[model samples]
Target: MKLIFYGEKLSNIRKLNGLSRKELAEQLDITEQAIWQYENDSMLPRIDVLNKLGQLFNVDTKYFFTQEYLIHKVSEEKIAYRAEDRESRKKTKLEITFVNFLDYYINFFEQNLLIPQMPIMDIREKTLKMLQETNEDRNECIKKIAEFVRTELGLENNKDLMYTLEKSGIYIVEKKLGTQIDAYSTVTQDGRLYIVLGTVKKSAVRRNFDLAHELGHLLLHDDVDMDILSSADLKTIETEAHLFASAFLLPEMQFVKDFQSLTRKSNPDYYIELKRKYLVSIAAMEMRAYALGLLTYQENRYFWGQLNKKQYKSFEPLDDEIPPVRPGKVRALLKFVLDKEVMEIEEICKEVHIRPDFLSYLFNLETDFFKPYLTTQKDYFGHTEVIPIGDFRDKTSTR
Candidate 1:
């Protein structure tokens, strides 16, 4: 059924605000069912209520007048054939809100900002056999590719992966994507590739791994649409990406050479120092060692058992000391535009349909950092100058 006046925008806005129907209805002096009906397009609010909603949602009432202005669900949007929902819940609440934010961000930038080109490889699958192969083979393939990419960029095996991607023109955005989603990558219609990282709360080790994993997808699976994959196929692709991440971060030769130098092969504590050196998890280092044939299966089992016994499963030493890496590429682009006076910050905020405060929060910026952009001497005109507030008189005040 067609919704009335694209009412789903209301749903998106309400969810973005973290409001339930009952709460929103209570504030709007309406019944929960009424709000539902309004959101279903079966009804529309009166003019006054519409004005109130505009203020409440910080969107113009005219935003409801067209379907183009309404937002689609995240999974239902551009990367429609792409986002994999492995969780039992089809769409989590946080996922919905995050997608809405992502859509707004992508749209605003695509419409207004100029994006730089990234020097990324479009890896073509050698054969159906390769995609259908064992995990070890896939990891081997990815390792070579990752190493080549690093060499081309003049980056070391342990270099900043995020910085490299940013400098190479891949746009990255970091946000609290809830625990379920670590990251997702997609190419826009204009061919701009983006990696959105959600595990910003996790340690740098996990986040770095995620960035590489997504990069793996960006390079290797550019032609494959994830939505079309069977469950088995999905698992294989996920495993392939994971193997890529493992191999990419711990370059086989470099890591093997370093591991051989360690006094004890079985000590997880020894890997702790390696973890600091490589910026990867102890578990990952253990797996890499096992993958490299340095540790026998029995030895690997014993190593994991010892780690489990020592309670190093989740939190490890220096985990908190290492901050989660953030994506500065998009932020850098924004700063570039602002610094060059390409457009006023107010124009950016207005174009994005958000207040400066919300922009700051989304970008992890300080409060009132964009306040200077909001200062307008004239109301929508270039000519009118601000009359001093101190010069106002009781008889002829223009406050």
Candidate 2:
């Protein structure tokens, strides 16, 4: 095969194996620049390097030479397919890569599980029908949904809920990938689903909507082609997801009752109260009001126009504060290992995919936290005594 075609196939295989160029180079004892060259079709790897690459990427050596492989390779790595476009100056390469990685991860998980066989459109219709028939209060609906998640996953708190979602193959990362993309969700190759949220979005309302939108995708459009969801067709999917989120967060019946109870006659104060109670944005509340026939089409239009003009504060409250950030997955895994007393600090660092320095960044301790957990023999009155770290948890010792 030609060098360019060979390089293209190599890149596809690398992505499929989830091996970054640096990781692959480290494994092969080669420079990352060399790996980049091979991926860019600028140079071909030596026959020995080719064989090693095949083994590392888990593809047969002959597979690279095939036309099918070349086509798949080109299609897979084409930057045009990326969620962000070239004109999007605000989006970084890291953001695009993270989103793509998330899609790949979700697809991987989905492929392993038996996703619902129903078509997404059908499911959406059915769910909407259920909502229409229920006539249940919004809080009751939210409580029910929360109960469903808790029962299914055995989650105890909001943090536990987040962890459960992650363990179930949902990917939520704490980084501002781009201004345009707050959060995104997608399915994996294996048919499992996932969601990724930008930690930079400090608003709980935004986070809640992101979660609900992702859940909408999972429940309403599992079988839809991912490409369609990324294209202009995405608008329809987004609209449906918005509806699902609004209804999921604030059922029509409860919202009407809540709105009626509020003494504030103006939309602004009413929205403030609604946002506080429901943990959703004022915009979402407005949409819910429109959907519930509380606000006429003209009223909805006027409200949005005022909002865009910045005439109102949009009901953001003083007490609506951002919470403290928690430790990420890698840190949490390390903590779990340390708490169980299963490994030394150095070993734990390696196992949890972090450097000692990075671990220090997560948890600022004087020394490695696992040092005190190690078992040691003590000399007491000439008798050798085994003093295990297990007793430290039993008694309150200053040391």
Candidate 3:
């Protein structure tokens, strides 16, 4: 039996930790070239150094030696980034790597468990089919699709959007994706759809809008090749998604009925009540109303002026009143697995070749989430038994 050292694993972990080779070398008290050598398979760290590497990264020492799992590879081209500055390929790569890690962790636990079938694929198919089958133009098509989604998902009025999305099998994760990015959506090669929401500027209404926008991307732009898209192409898709989100959140029929009461259609304050009812921002509602032809173009412009005058653009009324909804599906599933003893936390750590703390960090879980589930055994014969978890030996490394 022979053990192989995988340099790619070291590189990925380093990148995920946001460490440059020079920075990592400073921590390791080694030369920068040595870190590069270790990551490039030109040199292997000694036993003590390997253990230190594991401790630094909060992974089992064998993680560096073990063959990495083959989850769906995430590329920047496949991601719909909801940001203005989409130039950071490094950041994109880091995020995608993190998502892949999440994918592997999830797949490990969900192997035998029955989960809800993801509804996005079917919805996307139906949306495309409708586009082909109907004579409706793009905006009309989007509005009809949005209405259809609302009906299918049973999102009546202001029903809890986050809960419904999770119930419909969309894996949502709230992450610190910088202030520039609002959110991003991706469908893995295995058809697992994920929407990573940014925690920045995350009010309830804003979160809802982000979710709907990403949902629009998932349904409308799943087949788009983002790499080759020009600035204009990106803008066009963004506009389309925004329109979809507005329509989806504020269903035309219901919103029009609500809008009928606002005699002062140009007054931003008049839409506050509707905002509370729909749990959408005043600006968003104004846009929706204008899109629906309920507000004249001049009325919409006046509403914006009033909105600016009130200084409600950054933080609108009811932004604090409406409690932001947190994603609970992953947390709930983890609790269930732990409560049912399907897999102990420590055991899962060993299987995944990561430390319990790192595992918790990846999922944004509490620091002691795995503490209660960890079991302690008394030492016998002055020697603790060690069980090999994964293939202890491998001839080659595969990414």
Q: Count the backbone clashes (under 3 Å) in each candidate.
A: 1, 15, 0
Task: Find the 10 residues in a row with the least total lDDT in model 2.
Answer: 390-399
TM values, all candidates: 0.77, 0.53, 0.89
**On residues 278-308, what C-alpha lDDT tens digit does candidate 2 reach at each position?**
7677777777777667776777777777776
The best candidate in terms of lDDT: 3
All models, RMSD in angstroms: 9.7, 11.2, 8.3
lDDT on C-alpha atoms for all candidate structures: 0.65, 0.50, 0.78
The parts of candidate 3 lying over 4 Å away from their true place are 1-3, 29-31, 46-49, 375-399
Q: Candidate 1 on 253-274: residue-level lDDT in tens? A: 8899999888767778878788
Clashing pairs in 1: 4-41
lDDT per residue for candidate 3 within 306-336, as digits (tens), equals 8999999998888777777777777766755
* TM-score, ranked from best to worst: 3, 1, 2
